[model samples]
Target: MRYCIERLDGQHCLFVDGRKELLIYLKQASSETITDIRKVYRNGVSDSVLEIYLPYRKQ
Candidate 1:
């Protein structure tokens, strides 16, 4: 899986090539709680290439 930070529609987003569950977990990190978030699932053939988009906040 791969991870990167991006901005979509003027909002910070976390692009992760993995599960959507992981994205949710990341948004709720202990360092900074992210209350406003949106989840998006992209194309995936398997666990290795799954793409998930989640709202991200810099901590």
Candidate 2:
């Protein structure tokens, strides 16, 4: 399985895999949310890669 993550805003995130969709709610996420994301591949013999984008890190 492969996917891509995009930060919708400061309180929401979206994970997209090809045509599949997985919405991640971060309303209660803390500062550590940036590193609390996980992606796993379960399908075999597939040409896909998981792409994850963490929330904007405050500098």
Candidate 3:
């Protein structure tokens, strides 16, 4: 599975492919600002496992 980070309406968002529990856990555990988590489905398949809204982080 892969993940992508994007910006929508000025809010940072995350999208990750489904079926990977460890990946989800790792992301959540490593990030403190992640919130509004939800799943997305397409054609009844869980194509996107996580849609997390977070504040922008400065690197």
The candidate scoring highest on TM-score is 3
What's the TM for model 3?
0.38
Which 10 residues in a row give candidate 2 its minimum summed lDDT?
48-57
Cα displacement (angstroms), candidate 1, residue 4, comes to 10
Per-model lDDT: 0.42, 0.38, 0.44
Record all residue pairs in model 2 with backbone atoms less than 3 Å apart, i.e. clashing: none
TM-score of each: 0.25, 0.25, 0.38
lDDT for position 18 in model 2: 36
Worst 10 residues of 3 by lDDT: 50-59
- Clashing pairs for model 1 are none
Question: Which parts of model 1 have CA positions greater than 4 angstroms off?
Answer: 1-10, 20-28, 35-59
Clashes of each: 0, 0, 0
Which should have the higher lDDT, number 2 or number 3?
Answer: 3
